[model samples]
Target: MNSTKCQKCGLTNFATDLECKRCGTSFVQKTRNSGSRPKFSIIAVVMFAGVAAAFYYVFTGVQGSVDKVNSVEANRVNAQPVLPPDAGRSRADYDRYRSQTVANAVGVSPGLAEHANRTQQTDKAMDQMTNSRAQ
Candidate 1:
């Protein structure tokens, strides 16, 4: 069975074909019939392409912004000065100290001893608890 058609004269000789011997016609149709189930409409194809392009651009744009933010954060981490370890401090005090250090880097030096005292107070409280529990 000849599985191809001659596009030259509406001859359905074979469809999975290349060209008509009489007339050169591409058998593979790019557009489908309007009445078909999977009908191909110009408007529909354009709309789909447009939506795909929009989403692609939006995702790429947001990804670029995320990359920029991550780079900036990495730079901040690199630029930050590591503080010397202070004795007798809670985690919260250390966080505050880091904040102060960041502020100081930006030209606002907060006294390190202030929070250090608070850490010592916290340490004293913890010591009391430990002693009470031991008793």
Candidate 2:
């Protein structure tokens, strides 16, 4: 007795069966594979590869820029100011140099400097008055 295996239910049936007894699947029309890649699948694979390559290119470019920016920031953070040979030799010399620099800066706008001095004097007088009243 020759038997045929049902493709859907894996059940053995008689060779004369038109459908599987267990699953009711018809064996009359059978599906065939042609051993070739489908056009849609090939196009999908190509599109996926192109998208992956584009993402890789963008990621590498962004990583390079981030590295460059980090290096520049590290350089800025580690950088020190260049000083003159005679600068900061003694405390008096440093103080004198600092005062001269301040004077030069203030000389650019004398009225602003004068206003700042007046404000300082007024603050001192107010402090003195408060201290006297507290005492």
lDDT of 2 by residue, 1-135 (tens): 578798888999998888899999877664223234355678899999999999999999999999999999999878967656884489888889899998888877888699889999999999999999999
The parts of candidate 2 lying over 4 Å away from their true place are 1-40, 59-88, 114-135
Superposed by TM-score, candidate 2 places the C-alpha of residue 62 at a distance from the truth, in angstroms, of: 4.6
Top candidate when judged by TM-score against the true structure:
1
Question: For each candidate, what TM-score against the reference?
Answer: 0.39, 0.37
Clashing pairs in 2: none
Q: Candidate 2's error at 2, in angstroms?
A: 28
For model 1, what is the error of residue 87's alpha carbon versus the real structure, in angstroms, after optimal superposition?
5.4
Against the unseen true structure, what C-alpha lDDT does each candidate score? 0.76, 0.84
lDDT of 1 by residue, 4-120 (tens): 645357666455556665676655552243235576689999999999999999999999999999999999999999998788999999999999887676554346556766789
